[model samples]
Structure formats: structure tokens, C-alpha cells
Target: MSDTTRDGLADRFEENRPRLRALAYRTLGSAAEADDAVQETWLRLDRAGAGEVDNLPAWLTTVCGRICLDMLRSRTTRREQPLSEINDPPSAVESVLADEVEAALLIVLGTLAPAERLAFVLHDLFAVSFDEIAVVVGRTPQASRQLASRARRRVRAAAPAATEPRGRAVVDAFLSASRGGDLGALLELLDPDVVLRATGEAARLDAQGERRGAEVVARYFAGKAQAAVPALVDGAWGFAVFIGGELRVAVAMEIKNGQILGLTAASSPAALAGLTVTPL
Candidate 1:
């Protein structure tokens, strides 16, 4: 690639990185894998002589989607392990999306063929046209639409029953239980296999590599819940704890199956600054 082309690609990456990341995350269901897919997309673009391309953004997105599809295909071979084993444990962002796109949704997406997943994400999630999806999936426009339709039908059939209202109630209950320090109430709402992840400074302090199971989380909370008061983080149900009015920890919960399956607590003051906390 020429210097001019390289400069142009760099500019395009700066402009489109967030959108590309969003697409990959929605398609892959793992933030770490999404980052990998985006990186791979840039590598492919560099190899393809992207400086010569007129539509750098579109080209990058197509390359990113294709890379994500390839990664998803390889992921199918190892489906038995929990998602956290294959990728990083769920983060605050995943917890935010869990209410609308839970584990069931990810499983359903995994069931789809690569082309089908690409078609569906591009068309339904990104609002791309069939023509554009056809280019990305390497199918005719009609075939792309058919692929998306098939994927949509499968998702609908396998999806957990619409749980928007129920999910909201669950979050409310979790907050209530946490504030009251009711371990029994919290465990009652949590799955037996619940997974808890504490990132940034919290992970360093605990040195427990992100707790899992109802019992493990209960014990961890027994210690920290006293120190951390409840508050909302990032417009979702969350808790913010302060030490002498200085942010000390931020907790975010992901509830599924009437239980808490994922909880992420950030303790690094640097990381905490980027997060917005609201009164619970």
C-alpha cells in the first residue's frame, strides 16, 4: 500500500472503529473476540491494498463481517465449553445487552451457518439492504434475503420467551436483594451456575479470577457489599461504592433465567472514571 493509501486507511479506521466493533460484538457475542475480528479485518484490508479502494468504510465493514463469520465457523467445533472459557468473561457492556440478547440469542446465532449469520446481522441489526448483505455474504440478493429469513425464523423458534418486563423485574429484585444484603433472596434469583466477573482493580484485589456459582458470589459479596453502596451505572441497574466519597467500586449485574448469571465489578479508579453512576 502507498503512503497515501495507508494514511487514508488509518483515517477510516479512526472514523469507523466503534461501528465496526459494534457489528462484530453483535455477530460474535464476545467482546474480546470482537476486538480480534476487528484487528483481523484491518490486517486483511492492509493486505488487500485498501488505499486503492474508494469506499474504505464499506470495504472495512465487509472485511470485518467476513472475518467474524470465519471465526464463528471455527467456534462451532468447540461449543461444549462455557463462553467465558472461550473468551473473556462477560463485561459491563455484555451485561447491558443481556436483557435483549441473552445466552439463548448467542446460541441461536451460533447455530446459523456463517453466511446466514452475516446476512441477518447486516440486514436486521445494521439496517443494510439485501444488495449490501448479498455482497457481504457472497450470495445473490434473493439468496441473501432467504438466508436472513431462515436465520430469523430459527432465532424466533429458539429464542427465550419475550422477557422484557420479566427481566426488568429481575434487575429490580437483584438490586433490592443486594441493598438489603439478603443472600438467600439473591441466590433464589440466581442460577446454580451463575458466573461473576470482577475486572480492573477488583480482579486484582480478589485474585480469584472472576467467581462463578451462587455460593462463590455470595461469599464475595459478603465481604464487599458492606463496603460498596448500591447505585446505577451506565443507565442500567448497577451499584457504585465509594470510599470517603471517592469512587471505589462499580458493580453491574446480568440476570437470566430468573437468576444472576453475570456480574462485573470494576475497582480501578481509572476505569471507574469512564463509567457514569446514577442514584439507585
Candidate 2:
């Protein structure tokens, strides 16, 4: 393609960036990841010449959707360090997305299966039509419609876990299971989408930063927390690790609907100093 053609294609891609990014953000539930997917879509378009594309917007949508789907599938249950672990000023894109996406919605969406998420975001949110969604998810149009229906129900039902915290009885059981080193019991108390984030000395126990999924999180805590006892960290239901009567880590569980959704552990001396702990 000539420079003029390439330049015009670039301008059209830029025009479609916002829509592509919105679709990605809703599907992946991460603004940073959404930005990356849009950039990748642009790269693919750049390589495939404008002449090869007839409908620019629809072509961009399909490409971006596929990229997001691949990202969701390739992601592992355990993540070394989540973006939250990094301390950096939010970029303009992230800042804008912060207001556009609701925290509870993102949490709920993050838990859905990849095909379901893609289908729902494309058809329900963006009005992309089931036919187009089917192409992206590699399912028939009917199957894609079913995927969106399932995702819609989950989004509505799972909102509470994102809004308010519950599951103290579950936490008690989790701690009991952990103390005994019973992996089965520990796994039973965790949510499929459970995530664990630890900092300071706590990172030594499991790989630092974050770990996800019930099985992964369960294994991390199994046969562990032997020195930990139930307590309140900053007025929330959690635990504190004491080795030889010294508070080593302040731990908290974000429980929802009778299961644990998130676990946060702070073991640094300075971080430990700020918590209000009450033994129970």
C-alpha cells in the first residue's frame, strides 16, 4: 500500500480505538489490558493493508475481540504480580476508564468464563449482534447467544460479592482447614475466582504479589498459617500471623456469598504498625 493509503488507514484505526478499547475493557475487566489489545489490533491492521479490509469498523471489532479472548484464555490461575502491586500514577486512559467502569461490575465480569464474557460484552453491551460475536468466540450464533444469556444472569446474581463482604463462617472453616493442612477442606472454602495478594515478609510463603483460582490459592495456604490465629484487621474479618508472640503478618479475607473472593496479607513492619488487631 502507498503512504497515503497507509496514513488514511491509520486515521480510521485511531477513530475506532475508543470503541475497540471499550469492548476490550468490558471483556477483560482491566483498562491496561484493554489498551494493549487495541494496540495489537492496530498492529494487525497495519500489516494487512487497507485494501484487504472492506468494512473497517467491523473488521477492527472482530480482530480486537479475538485478541481479548486469547488473552483471557492464555492467562494462568496464578499471576506473579497484579497491577495493583505496582505504585504508579494512572495514565490518562486508565483515569478515564476508572469512571467508565464500575468496580463491582469489573469484579463480577472478571469471574466469568472467556467465551461468556466476550459474547456478553459484544452483544449485550456493544450491540455487536450474535453473528459477529460468534465469529470472535468461534461458536455458532445460537451458541454465542446462549453464552451471553448465561453471562448476563451471572452478572446480575454475582453483584453482591462485589458490593458487600460476607462469609465469616466460611473464613472460620478456611482457617481451621489451613491449620490442619487439609487441602480438600481449604479448597472447599475458596471461590473459583479467588485471588491472594501478599506483601512484605508474607511474599516469602507464596510467590510474591498475587495468586488466583481456588486450587492455586488453596495450595498456597494448605498446611500453612499454622502460626496464624483468627482476628480482625482494621475492623474487617481476617487473621494475624504470630510467630513467638510477635505479630508478623496482618491478613484479611474479602468474602462473598459464602466463599472467599480475595485475600490480602501485609507482613512489613510499617504496614503491620497501622492495623488494628483484635484477637477472637
Q: Which candidate tops TM-score?
A: 2
Give per-model TM-scores: 0.49, 0.54
lDDT of 2 at 189: 81
Q: Give per-residue CA lDDT, model 2, range 1-280, as digits (tens).
A: 8999999999998888777876777677666777899999999999999878999999999999999999999988512222353243444224434332344345456657889988988886778989888899999999999999987775554433334434445667888898788888987788889888887767655454788899988888888777777765654567887887888888877876677778889989988987755444
Off by over 4 Å in 2: 78-101, 165-280
Predictions in order: lDDT: 0.68, 0.75
Candidate 1's C-alpha runs over 4 A off are: 1-5, 76-104, 158-280
- Model 2: ten consecutive residues of lowest lDDT: 78-87
The most accurate candidate by lDDT is 2
Backbone clash total, candidate 2: 0
The lDDT, on a scale of 0 to 1, for candidate 1 is 0.68
lDDT (Cα, tens digit) per residue for candidate 1, span 38-88: 888877777877646678777887888888878877784533222444343
